[model samples]
Target chain A: MVSLQAAVESAAPVSRLHERASFDPADFPVPGGREEEWRFTPLRRLRRLHADGPLDAGKAGVEADAGPEITVVAAEHGDPRLGTAFVPADRVSARAFASFREATIVTIPGGVAAERPVVIRVRGEDAGQAAAGHVLVEAGANSSAVVVLEHAGSATYADNVEFLVGDGARLDVVSVQDWARDAVHLSHHHAVLGKDATFTHMAVTLGGDLVRLAPSVRYAGPGGNAELRGIYFADSGQHLEHRLFVDHARPDCRSRVTYKGALRGDGAHTVWIGDVVIRPEATGTDTYEANRNLVLTDGARADSVPNLEILTGEVVRAGHASASGRLEDEHLFYLTARGIPVEEARRLIIRGFFAELIGQIAADQVRAKVTAAIEAELDAMARAEGGAR
Target chain B: MSTLEIRGLHVSVAAQAGESREILRGVDLTVTAGQTHAIMGPNGSGKSTLAYSIAGHPKYRVTSGSVTLDGRDVLAMSVDERARAGLFLAMQYPVEVPGVTVSNFLRTAVTAVRGEAPKLREFVREMNGAMAALSIDPSFAQRNLNEGFSGGEKKRHEILQLQMLNPKIAILDETDSGLDIDALKVVSAGINAYRQSPDHGVLLITHYTRILRYVRPDFVHVFVGGRIVAEGGPELADELEASGYERFLAMEGAPA
Candidate 1:
């Protein structure tokens, strides 16, 4: 007979007991394949990021540069606002929280508006090394700013990032994971919005062996607004996942989430989960979330799940939707019926899918870079498939 | 001079559960350069299938027939290949291709058909000229192809593509079906300009002769149950206009 803890610690990948989100690492157990959240993720391919493994701060390289109106510091350890935004919902994020060596803090002065976006670049050096990272960002009252976090290179990385928005502040965060093919990344992003504050989070994932990201939003006061948007592309042998949660804890808050992804080639898989909860006390709340996935090849698979938990019938409105489908045959016929070839039509459709989101990027340079990357990925997909199906 | 010749053309489409139903049973017609042939038929008479079959739509299978464009075997070509071989099909219901703007869609088609991309200035001038002729808004060029477009807009957009492509043979499938009188005039004017090309051949498919008032046909064929049962001069359209297809539907043990 095997004990529950022993069973969870065992090598066999099975389902473990469930627990609510916890900030403490001990509150969570090693994830088996059966856990609701972990079932879609490939455990064996995670490179020990989900189980007990080496997490070295020295092995990871992070470079941070803040704008003139912003202040940045490398703190040794605990900040009272660290876990207030979001508790760890999985073992990997909890382990990252418990094992993070040094934390970076980005701060904006009260009522000071930043003209330029702050930039942070994280690059993993050794492919064999597993690393944990933590970042805390706080926006002062009535201050507005944008933050960009770009990831690249190769490593097994698990990290947590939190955003604390002050009243009447407007903040936009664009987190891009353009990792190497051998890299594995698991991250949790939590943003807490103050009264009348507006927050926008955009996640763009293009490269990784298996990258799982969960971004959640919570209201610290009434009249807060949150917008979450994401775009991802998965090629052969790549697994990319995004999970989002919007918790409307205060009254009269509004939230919107839209995510679009494309998958191509054999073994390419993408999973998107969107959850919105309107608490009973959160009357007059309005929220909508949608996820759309387009599969471009025969072997690629996309899974989209949208859940809405509305406890208050007095709320203004709430809805959620998720859909995943292959390239529409009617769209293809529309193009081929013209003189355009099948391959070119496929390219145009995929480009059109990402054009709307890419247009929302305020930084022209970043927008151009992301567009170039998308075009490159489309070219690669065209080459791999030889022609359109 | 160009010509689209169909000889004993028979087409079938797969029905549910692996059954094949013949839509076109021996359709025979010939369209020559500088000539407009209006094929008038009732509903379910397979007029649209004839146009689609000529464009190499995969849904319509050519069982036993010959469709040749200027002595070239058009039935052997792929859909895009057929379009490149000087064949253009203005669909009855233009498909909505989301994310692809009208400008991009036309540019791609023109490039594929002409084997070279048009000069930017020339392309813009031509597009503006065509849009002006059709009374389409300049902003329509930036909109996605046929998406959320009204029926009249879709028809005008189709003619816009026809004007840009300049194909040898143009098949207009129910181009006048949903157009208001005003839109019908604009679309007919665009087609008339294409007709001015000395080598252009037009095969107009319509259930009503309302469009014939604007774009006159040199020959009219009465199609019923996929075959041309009667052929006559322009007077035939007037005869059909005055007397409906009830005369043809009355024939028993024969194609409707």
Candidate 2:
């Protein structure tokens, strides 16, 4: 019963109107604490990383682990492939784009199937210092690969990750933000899918003082498919946010988005924004988005917004849904009345809530690690509350 | 020999517009091992309240009562404690848990009740045998518990648990309400099998006497106006079926 991580599968989406895209840091000025994107964030807690601060990583670094069929290149600024598939939408993304002296470029050879995942480990060694990073992953035509961008340690950091999926390629990227409790990290992910290509992105954010991510996808040709999935847990005094967008500008494209989150303790806050758009020329486009949140204790807040805009009447399907609530008393009672302890019952329900998304993870070690981390969070909450709740 | 003793149980529920309505008023009943007591009543006559109160449902406030099992105060125990104390209630309406599969739920309940986890192979073997006996598909073991299940499936699953948990006393609340003839027979067989064990007792609550034809009760009690009005042997069920509770409804002073 402790390892039922593989059995649960299940959600449905929310949206807020937004229109801001730029590559120049000047074009996107510092958030004055009142903008829609920065309102939920505590500006003072950012440690002035949003201002004219240091961008050199100093001790923070990135390391790649891959097989011989793949190439991990370190290219300097003005690398032609660095920003070809990415556009900085916010000031943090723009600053991260302008500040990095070098970027990590990962290329998977065409028609090559990797036996193991390409793990890009981003680790920080200092908590008081600020840094920015950039990584671009190119999946060659007919290639199949899984890239894991894992973050750990402590630092004030910002980064931009771009994935260019070539024709008939399949690329799945999992970004896990298991940072130190004192770390503040922000990131943006841009993905472009070619004809008949398949792309998937999963975000796992469990540890950090403040973590925000925006992952967007664009279809570059017809018959492309993209799916976005995320699972996150916020502890006491933590902020986690994810903003997602999927654009269908080509005919015969499909997209799906689902994210689930749980928050416990005082001042625990989480947010999800899903925006999907189907344009006029995009005939036969299909899309749906959903977000669900569970608030385990008092003083925690979760905001979910799902928006779907369709300018063409020729599309097949377009829908969205959002739900944010506390645990159901009936579920707890059902489990407890069957002889399960109340604490164990609560743990099961919370784990089941996130199992739907976590079950989709293909890597066994990564899934086990995520499960262990969440279990630790649940244990901490039980100790703090003394199982009374 | 195990026995469940109930004395002077008074239960109430919250009513609309800031008021309280009594559901079980000074009712008393007892069931010893090897006994099946059938309590038949009309609609809204507090039959379910008796079953729920005995199971420690939070909605049923036990204003004044005492329920004990072999000298232990069952009223002092929480819901799970009651189950661990050898009391079970096969609920008429089982709640649907979205992600917990049937097999996982059954194993968890068995472990909690038994106080030790069973071996995986042994558990699966027992589960498969029980499932086959109940005529349930093996694929149902992976489906979520009671989620998107038919009425018959839910009822059969309840009896399956009744057999699996093997509690000392079981209060079956309307287990045959929505069952077809075949399902009713299967579920009744499951219940009968559970009753075969020594130190096991049953309190079957229902509105009709059709199920009595299959699983005969040892005693029949006429329930009306939140209390038992009459008690007799199994023949009383046949008499009540022939002549409905119309005469019993007109008996002594009853509250609306």
Candidate 3:
């Protein structure tokens, strides 16, 4: 039983060994497979990583890239208090108690529109170790921007990211998580929207051994809104899960969550759990959540659950729906009857499934990049099953 | 050389399984190029079923029949293969494919049926020309295929596909069902435009005589109880339209 305070304090690394001491795997606490949240996850996947050793930070590479119409604010160790305020100390302490400590802080100034995307690139060098980072975004009143966070590795790694959005500002955040096949990824993103603010987040997950993404958003002010969209594909012994929580804590707030995933090959499992809550005082709140899963193979499995907990009696609208099924035979028949080959028809349907989320992406470059990545993933899966035509 | 030949065709729905309540009971018909053939039938007379079976719908089981396009056996091929063999069915109810633009769908369908990739600029130019001819707005190209479209719009979309695909044999399954007079004229004009090549054959299925008045059929067949009972010149459509299907029903009962 580790305390949250101890975890935060432990994240404060000694100056001399900043590079080596920053991401040491030995300092984190193990889950021991008993926690309820970790029940469905395979802890052995984490055990295979190096449990007690410093990360090879010297091997880390920095490749800075610019994105479309996004403003990037890079502040390393800008202010520890900023991180403390954005990320609750208790959650920081938990990661710290688990011996994972590394941070990246980003800020967008008020009323500033960056025409190019701000890309935050994080890389890990070790195959069997853990790493964590933090991002804090502040958009001033009447400002808009987009942030592209890319997580990649030349080797296997486990990582986490925390994000925050500020008041009266709109933020479009795109996350591309493509790790090595042997890697395990655990990402935690927490966002808080302020008065009259709007936030749109889209995540594309294409590669990983066992990937779990928990994105939680809270509407803390009136007229605040959040739109969350994600696309995940798993194939050949891959396990991908996305758990989302959207809380409407104030009146006149709205939120929407949509996630779609495709699975192929045996032993592949895709899971989605969307939980939305409208508190008692959060009157005039509107929330809608939907999750759709496509199982491409007979042995593949998809489990989707959309849960809504509404406490307010004056809410305008609140509902959640989930669907898990194979491709529709009628759609396939219609396409094939038009002279499209069966394999091409399947590809088109899969592409169309993800196109819904991709179409909602406001930025053209981001949408194109995500679509290309998804197609590549599908091609790889098709090749693995020897079903590519 | 374009001709659709059906011999001893027996088709049934999948739900009935081996019980086999035949929709096209041993029906034989020949439709050659350079001719318009109208199939007039009453409701539940299996007009659309015959059209679907010829186009290779998965639900329409061909118990013991053979459909040939030109010299190629159509029944032995897949739906897509039959389409590529130059057979087209203008579905009475076109399926809506959300998120797929009509232009993209038509382009893919045309290229697939032709077995070659078409030049993009040329395809667009030709598509625009067809749209204008069909009285369809240019914006319709950007919309999802047949989604949220009015009944007339759906029928126009089917005609647009017909003009673009340009199959050797086109089967129009009640293509004039839901159109107003203006839309019907526009659609008939588009179909007439497709008649430039005598190598193209048309199997027009309709319960009314209005479309036949516009696109004057060269031959007419009266279908009753899942079988064609009588065949005559274009005068037969006028006869059927004037006297209804009672004469055809009596002819069918004559047992010849």
lDDT string, candidate 2, A1-389, tens digits: 01112211111111233356678888877788998777877888887777767787545789999999999999898888889886777788888899887799999989998889999999988978788889999999999999999999997898899999999999988899999999999888999999999998999999899998899999899999998999999988899999998878899999999999999889999989887867667889888898999998899999897766666667777788889998888888778878888788888788778777778886777888988988998889889888654
For TM-score, the strongest prediction is 1
lDDT of 2 by residue, B10-64 (tens): 9999999978999988788999999999999999989999998988888889899
Query: What lDDT does the true structure give each of the candidates?
Result: 0.87, 0.87, 0.75
Model 3 misplaced stretches (Cα beyond 4 Å):
A1-40, A48-93, A96-98, A154-160, A381-389, B16-21, B246-256
**Model 2 local distance difference test score:** 0.87
Off by over 4 Å in 2: A1-18, A387-389, B251-256
Better of 1 and 3 by TM-score: 1
Model 1, which residues run further than 4 Å from truth? A1-19, A387-389, B251-256
**Residue A154 CA displacement from its true place in model 3, Å:** 5.4
True contacts kept of each: 0.62, 0.52, 0.50
Q: What DockQ, between 0 and 1, does each candidate earn?
A: 0.67, 0.66, 0.46
* Poorest lDDT segment (10 consecutive residues) of candidate 1 chain B: B247-256
Judged by DockQ cut-offs, the docking class of candidate 1 is: medium
